[model samples]
Target: MKRALEKLGCAPVLEAADGIAAQEVLCRHADVALVLTDITMPRMDGLELLRWGREAVPGAVWIVLSGVETFDSAVAAIRLGAFDFLPKSPHSEELAVAVRNALERRQLLAERERLYLELQRKVHELEQTSEALRRDLQRAEVIQRALLPHSPPPMEGYCIQAVYRPGQHVGGDLYDVVRLGERHLAFYLADATGHGVTSAMLSVLFKQRLVLVDATSGLPLSPAAVLDAVNRSICEAHAAPGLFLTAVFGLLDTSNASLTVASAGHPPVLHLRAGRETRLVRRTGPALGLAHDAQYHEEHLQIAAGDRILLYTDGLVPSGTERDLHRLQQVLAEQRSSVQDILAQLHDAAQGAERDDVTVLLLDAHAGASWFDNGAEGRAAAASRAPRTEQDVVFYGEADEAAWLALRGRATWMQSDVFHETGQAVLAAQRPLVLDLSACEFMDSTCLGTVHELVARGGVTLVGVAPGVHALFEELSMGDVLATVRRDAPAAPELYAIGAGSSQAAVQQRILQAHEALSSLSTRNREEFRDVVESLRGDQQAGGGHG
Candidate 1:
């Protein structure tokens, strides 16, 4: 039998005298693929060997053979997990077919086992990766929460409230209420273009770059100017197509309850008065980062006692319909209780599953505040205490020596005369000009352009530059020039005054020169100020002045 099997290409077949011997041989040769055995054996029967071998070599295939084949014996052998049972001394062709079929079965079982183990390994690896991603998202959500305000700053006779709810682990809505100097309170709400980590990152950049106070001036910027500056910055550095933000910024003068608001493609702000009609502060410009030269217009309103202003993201009204907005307005108008209660009512009113981030900021004026009445008498009282405008420009040191030019108060187009006269005088003397902006509260685009012109002429240094101003310069692509400038302490000496009072033609000339200088700084500046420069030139020619 062994010779026959070897002749059929089954090599190195081990022979055993009985089932017991077969067990011993099988134990020693664990790598055996197929087992051919007889139904009757000496020490142990084939059925017993088959059962024992099944456990020892689970992957091996078994076939039974007997000299006197019986139906009962064949059934017993087959029940014990044998692949085939045949009479002993069978045809050579039948023996070959049985052995071949059994070996093929063995190969299939081995492959099945391999694939099962591999599937388990891959599933385990996927589970580990999923767990790590979950942990990372948790950390990111914590950091995003930290960027939000824990509590609003205290203001007399006013109540400020904010609520933020992200639909996912992290969201794209951001809001901040910052106190600018002593009198102005600035607040804004921004919503990025999309959801998830990318949008969250964009919102963070907006928060970092939003300049509430002017760097050159120590005072707060107007709402429109604040939005315009932020838009210009986003357009210059981070403008990706289809990526923009909707925002509304407001500046509140606490002394007289005057609120100036500006919006960029944002939902209208709801103004709820105590007993009058609810008003909407609507958008004045396109969304941020859409256009470099987009202009924002300001809307000024008086906040009376017991009035409330609600600023929210579109998530608060996902439907974005007139009925939904009216419902929100009705809720704000009816809910005269605490801001928290109003927010809860608003949330309850929101229908369907939340698909976006929801953010709401509420400003409430307390009842019976005498200062809330923004009448002419109140304005007169506030004006009486307002600081008088000081000399904006003063020059120190003689023309021959290195000179210092100080800018105080608000520097705008009105100060172009002083800037032109002093700048020309310093250039004629061939002296290095050091500009002092320590006491300056604000600088308009015209003034910034004039400063740019002086820098272009060479030998110019800017000192006491505030962080906001530095960011502005960098956004306008003036960082290379500013990088070489040095900071130095101003010297106290005789001050020479240059009045801003000048002819219309001279003022037009200064505006043109300043814008032209700014336009030369960057391509974006050139595109932005091109119209203003051309318009001024046209005006100059019409007035018979040199263009």
Candidate 2:
């Protein structure tokens, strides 16, 4: 058998006397690939050796041979994991075939085991790499969060609040409210184009370059000029296609409640008047990094008592639709509690909808207080001040007939309930109600929503709508009601005051009803105001009103 295996080029074939001797050879030569054994050998049989060899030298293949082979012996040898079973004294050609087959089987098994070990090593390496990446991301997330403001700066006669929620461990939304000088406050909200490490790095660059003062002149830049500078910096630093950011910057003159705001492809700044209609300070320039010389425009307006300016990233409203903006406006108008509560509500809404990185900054002007003094004495004096008796609405006719209601000065939520009560009474009595806005300088969201409710019903007319008031209507997408507007109306007479005093419950109900009326105008309005309406309903039930 050894001579025949050698002829088949099986080199250095070692001979064993019996199964026990074969075991000794296999134990010594751990690299042995093939074993030929006689089933009936002394000390230990081929089957026993085959079983022991399988456990000791698992890679070796076995071939059993016997001159007087019994069917049972051949079966035992084959069942013991022998590669081949052949009779003793067979032809050299037959033996060569068996040895060749056994060696080939051993080679295949060794190669398979080698590949498996290699695969296991690769899997371990991948797991380590994945864990390293996870740790890096966690560290990045902490750094990014640290860059955000912990709280807004304290300002006299004003309340500032902010909320930032990143969609991922790292996000691209950033906001800051910094005091530019003794009398000026600068606030901004910026959003990079995407969400990830790259976008986050770009947002960091934006923060670093958001210079409020001119480097050369050492003078504070205007809101528009600041945006222009930011845009130029980004355009120069990052010329990559599809990379950009939207931002809104505002500079406030703390002394006179004047606000100058500019936007670069960002969401409109929400101007929420306490108890009045909300207005949008629209965007005025292209997105930053889009053009090297993009010019931005600024809008200047005087902030009033109980007024708030809301700046947010697009992540707050992922859809970026007219309806979505209206919804946010409605939320601001409805949530007249504290700035913190408003931010919480907005953040919850954004999170519930699974939005991207969301950031909201609110600036509120305190009512009836001096910007220079927000001390306890000032607050006590403000609390002790008499309620305003200046009539904002004057009725000229009876409720049973055509009634003329002249809205004087700024018709806001403080007086919206009075007008709302009179308008409803007149409308309910099947009488004609005419609203005179010729003397009205401004009408807030509450009053506008009240007017919307009255107009939605029949027998209402609006005359002498001022350009600003007309623009408000257009912005709310209530242009259809503008069809009832006339160039002029007859002079009103016998004016009677619609008093603006009401219980807390009545005021809450009025605000709720006004927003409900606005919500009924369109499907989008309904969706946007749905939560506000439900919340109002709960508040009304709980005897709770805006703080």
Candidate 3:
């Protein structure tokens, strides 16, 4: 039967040929487009041959030759990704058309493969670039972390807990507890204007200048003075375009009982007392880097034991509307119910997720407890001496010899820095050190405020204060400018009556209630009553008590 077909010029069908041989021939020869094979084979069948040929040969076409015209065979050929199936009695033109169509389809598919490979190559290149950029960003983050202080500086009589989170990989928020000397603890939290790494750069710039001012001025610069000087320097440095800083700078005297704070365009600082009440402190100056003379307010906070001072950037408020911000303050207050409670609140607030660059600094005014922060042992020592406020020092822009001499004469106890190691050395000596201002001319209000805080918080006395520094003091008053100054500085020259000014009459009444509560308390609840009284007194005095 096969010979008869062969005599009619038909090729002898090798029905038992294995799929491997069929595949090899299809791949090896460029001209072999049509696949002619029997359904049943020794090793592999005709359907397997068709599928293999279709994949291996870019433009290969398949035609199955079957002895039986069964539906199952036809279905199997299609299932194997095979081309057209033919019976033994198929017409010539039909065969020709099927073969032509398959060849055309394979050609179209070959072009598609080429385009896909090209697309894959481009995609790989894009992925490589993205990876490189990610690496670069990671490197930048490392450098930024290196620049920040490893641990919060130590103070003699205070416990400070601060949580700083950058909104992005690098944020503009900057906080550092600088030890100007043994007695002075200078800590500042600064938030640059706007967002992104540009703001962070400004923060970096402010820190560098702050350190520079401490070194060169040789003065016991207060928090206000530092803010003023830093603000001016930043303004001058970035005055070219739009740049500013909303910041808070504090100078604490752990040995004494005063905290001097200065604010520049930051949010109103909160003073949380034990009475389950909170007060907003509006200090002045201006944000750093705004303008050369942008004013900042300074306030004194008297602290004893069991009191807290909360310092934060504006991200906590989300715009001061409603009580969202105040709620955060309340949360802070209740958390102090215990350490465990505080930790829980902190964990929830910052489960490593920050809405913005939310930063919080809590100063435990009650000097008994010690704080382990940022790898540093933070302690605030309570001086067993009388209170003292800011002394006098001339503002210097550039270094000068004559001004330096005047500062030396004016201030017996000079302070430079107390938060960092170098600042610690400059400020620690118990002597009435004279600060050098020969290299400084322009001064920032934060430095002035810091000096004030030291005087109020520590036992250092504020003597021979220059009138020039007074203007900055008056400008940052929330109300009762004189009252604020006096209360902030324990070493104030003269004491004023509690209700001296008519403007503060109501304020004095409330204040008297608090003070009387403290002064008239009996021995039984002295500690408990004293805590509330001291806190209330501090709140009312905003000007008198030193930390």
Clash number for each model = 3, 6, 106
* Candidate 1 Cα misplacement greater than 4 A, ranges: 1-9, 66-68, 87-97, 236-242, 337-339, 346-355, 367-547
Please report how far candidate 2 places residue 391 from its true position, in Å.
69
lDDT per residue as tens, model 2, 312-431: 887777777998888777777764554445555655555664447777777778732212111112222433363545563543332213556778787877777667766666566465
Relative to the unseen true structure, what is the C-alpha lDDT of residue 40 in candidate 2, on a scale of 0 to 100?
Answer: 86
Candidates 1 and 2 compared: the better one by lDDT is 1
Residue 423 lDDT, candidate 3, scale 0-100: 20
Q: Which ten residues in a row have the lowest lDDT in candidate 3?
A: 396-405
Worst 10 residues of 1 by lDDT: 369-378
Predicted candidate 1 versus true structure: per-residue lDDT over 1-547, tens digit per residue: 7877999999889989999999999999988888888878888988889889999988788988876646588788788789997787778888999998989888887889899999999998787567545544533554565566544666777878776766665788998888777788888999998887878888888888788877797789898998999899888877578888999998999999999999999999999888999999889899998999999998998999989999989888767788878978887877555444555675546645655777888888873221111011222343346554465354333221345676776778877755756665666546567787766777777888888877777888777777766676777787655764556655533334433555456677888888887888889999998999999888888878943
Candidate 2 vs candidate 3, TM-score winner: 2
Whole-model lDDT values for every prediction: 0.76, 0.75, 0.54
Can you give the TM-score per candidate against the true fold?
A: 0.62, 0.62, 0.50
lDDT of 3 at 522: 38
Q: After superposition, how far is residue 544 of candidate 3 from its true place, in Å?
A: 72
Positional deviation of residue 381's Cα in model 3 after best superposition, in angstroms: 32
For residues 463-512, what per-residue lDDT tens digits would candidate 3 score against the true structure? 34445555544544312223333323222111110001112333334333
